[model samples]
Target: MEINILAFGIAKDIFGASKVTIQLSDAATIAELKASLEERYPKLKQLASYMVAVNNEYAESNLVITERDEVAIIPPVSGG
Candidate 1:
């Protein structure tokens, strides 16, 4: 399955684009997606932390991702 991910903040820089496309198994989980992303973009692993949002809601590691789902990479945010 091909997943389209929207990047935000530092995540955009890590991916070098606001949006990216990646290939995964038909039944890939959020954990699998994170692993694949870190593998492809080593810089992502350097972040303190990040979150994955599916269909406008924060998703858990075990959540299954579908090709039709809306996914986003939310990098850590620090505000004064």
Candidate 2:
């Protein structure tokens, strides 16, 4: 399955784009996707913290990601 991942904040800098395309197995989980991304983009593993959001909601490691799912990379943030 082909999943389009949206990048934000520092994630955009790491990916060098606002979005990226990743190919995964049909029943791939968020954990699997994170591993795949870390392998492809080592920078991702360096982030202080990050989370994967599926369909606009924070997803757990076991959350399944489908081809139609809206996945996004959300990095840590700080505000006054």
Candidate 3:
């Protein structure tokens, strides 16, 4: 399955684009997607932390992801 991901903040820089598409096995979990991303973009592993949102809501590691789902990467944010 091909998953389209929207990147924000540092995540966009790490991916070198605001949006990216990746291929994954059917019914892959958020954890799997994270691993795949870190593998493709090593800089992702250097982040303090990041979150995955599915369909506008934060998603858990075990949450199953489908091709039709709306996915986004929310990088760590620091504000004064």
Global CA lDDT of candidate 1, please?
0.95
How much lDDT does each candidate structure score?
0.95, 0.94, 0.96
**How do the residues 1-80 of candidate 3 rate in per-residue lDDT, one tens digit apiece?**
99999999999998999999999999999999999999999999899999999999999999999999999998887878
lDDT value for candidate 2?
0.94
Q: Kindly list the per-residue Cα lDDT of model 2 for residues 1-80, writing each as its tens digit.
A: 99999999999999999999999999999999999999999999899989999999999999988888899999997757
For candidate 1, the TM-score is 0.95
Candidate 3, which ten residues in sequence have the lowest lDDT sum?
A: 71-80
Off by over 4 Å in 1: none
